[model samples]
Target: MPQWSEYTDGERIKILRGMETRQSDLAEMTGLSLQTIQQAEQGKRLTLRTLIRIADALGVDTSVVLGQQAPRRSMQRDDRAMVRDLSRTVHDTAAGLLDITDPPALEELREASKACWDTYWRGSYMEAGALARPLLEQAAARLHDQPADEQAEAWGLLADAYRLAAYVANLIGSRDLAYAAIGHAQHAAEQAADDVRRALVMSGRSWVYLRDTRLADALTLAERAATDIEPKFSTATMEQLVAYGSHVNFAAVVASRMEDKERAADYLSQSHATGARMGQEYRAHGTVFGPVSATTQAVGINVALGETGKALSLIGDIKPVHERVLSGAARNRYAMDKALAQADAKLWDASLETLEGALLAAPQWARHQVLPSVIVSRVATGSTTRLRRVVELIGTASSTGGFPPATPRNAL
Candidate 1:
């Protein structure tokens, strides 16, 4: 038998989906849309949750599907495999532990849940996804056994876990998983009757919409979420500050994506105001928000608006001191935005340099993201050492096949 790792994900799926099981069968069993199954079979990206669903439906260990790591054609391709394998392990393990009648110790559960956030912020999506499943399952089980007095607290924790799962799923390109997870989070938050958590769930939903390119829905949801949590910066707790600021920033990003510069700028101004109140970057509810994050995100927004000079200026204003404090994912995203700015300025070498740094910082995440592919497509065709290294890291010119064209200099 050929090693599963030797084949691309689509090929592996085809192999597993023998004559006995049709694509429709897998889709039905996994609770995934036929489109998702088809995409996976066509070698398009599938999220961790989707991969887990498929593996479980097929009744095989995830390792059977993933096999040992092999050379992938591109970073995007590699990420699809990594997330799929991790998702399988998480779901399979969680399924087996579902019969436990007793709740886990609260402190242990808290620590485990915290670890998931830390892992994700550090840009280890597979590790975070693995941790999230147990945290979500165990906390959800607590809802059945915990005392009535502790029910609200249990629900709150479960909501957080669900929200974390949603975030993890989103990171792994599990669109449907993200949707379901956020829905659960919202329900749990409602059960907990926590206003703050409810608002956070709304923001999470907005994030899902953003990922799906539902820009109008994302903007509307984000605005509503921000309004729900608009605390007075002076008297608000750090957590409140972060949540409100993050929601507003998300609204700004959505507006930018929609090419509504006026609305985007308005949202950015609000975000800046919130950031000024916070005075520094603050993280809460698995989101990081403040002056630095706002400024960094704004660079991308400006780039989206085709204001490359403004984006470059924003890049210049950011100090190394602030850069060092960004999480690995944030740092890489900022680098890609900077590279986009450079590419627009026709500084191809500088753009490549920025992308090289980003690839090294978070290679796994980089491989799955479109930004790296976009940068590579726009770079000069000549083969320099840096270009060759980027090709090695991200795959060939063909890896970006069928991707939308580069944003024109005057697209906005």
Candidate 2:
């Protein structure tokens, strides 16, 4: 057996295809052209979707083709169980969680929502989502029982619970689950009649679009949602300010991904203005948006736009206030973006340091993110020791016992 990284993609595909399966058969099964199959086996360029299709046709995980660790059998079973549990929670009725005549107090609902948000921000996604399911059931059931004046708040709480589920699923790379969760949020927001909460749900929808590579739709929705939530800074509450700023920042991210640097900059500028109005870091409606967050997100937007110099310049401007303000996940993501800028500039050592530091700060979050893996792959050829360390931290480094998957140097 050879180290997974040592073999070319074509060789791995050939081995995976084996003697029993022919290229024509694989092409037919995967709905890919015979030529495409041949090209892939010859180590030609293939899109991620195409690779995934091929991997699935072979009855294997994408990791099998990418030369990464195949998930353990136990992990696979757990994932299946989670999916089942989520489905049941989403479809099942809340029959006995609360009395129809005497619902839980509004304050209790608010506290439960707040606690769930805290759990998510603290990076306890699994726990938070588990908590959210029951909260949602109770909230949904209680929405009809609330007085006319309090019904909106009840709906808002339900929306938040659904958003929690969607956010957690998105973070974990479960797009289908995320879509289901977002749908529930959208319906709940409609009932709530809350512009800010509706905008928040739109933000989640944009993430699902991004995951599917629908950049145009993602940008359009995010921009429209941001516009819809734009408040008069002079009178807007802190919560409104946070949601507005966060939505605008998210629009900037979508713009950058769509390669519209000017649009991205415009959105980012608007976010900065909103943050200026807020004055300090504020987490509201499950979003972190303030001066620090705008600056931090700006770094990533600049990197995505290929403005390495500007990205680096922004990094230098990050103040001590930022360290105390941003969430651990946000800080780590910013560090990863800085590392990307360094790598693009060929400052390999600085890139490695930034990358390593981020992994150390939030190992679990970093491991689940695709960015760290992408960055490490870029720098891996130069420093074997650093590569190994990153691989260890991520827990998916190539093993000698498994076959290598096709990994183009510029895949990310």
Candidate number of the best TM-score = 1
Q: Candidate 1, residues 1-412: lDDT per residue as tens digits?
A: 3444667777767665655567898899889999999998888877889888886775444654565433222223224444455455335433444555776877777777777788888877766776776677688677767888888878888888888878877765566668877887898899999888999999899988888877788889999999988897668998998888888888888888899999988988988888888888877767788889889988998998888999999999999898888887788789989998988888889998888888876776664466776777888643499888987777533233212122222211
Cα-based lDDT for every prediction: 0.75, 0.75
Question: Candidate 2 lDDT, tens digit per residue, 109-175?
Answer: 8888888888877766656767877777777777877777878888888888888888877765556
- Give the Å error, residue 28, model 1: 27
256 Cα displacement, candidate 2 (Å): 0.4
Residue 244, model 2, lDDT:
91
> Residue 196 in candidate 2 has what lDDT?
90
Q: Which ten residues in a row have the lowest lDDT in candidate 2?
A: 71-80
Model 2: what TM-score?
Answer: 0.75
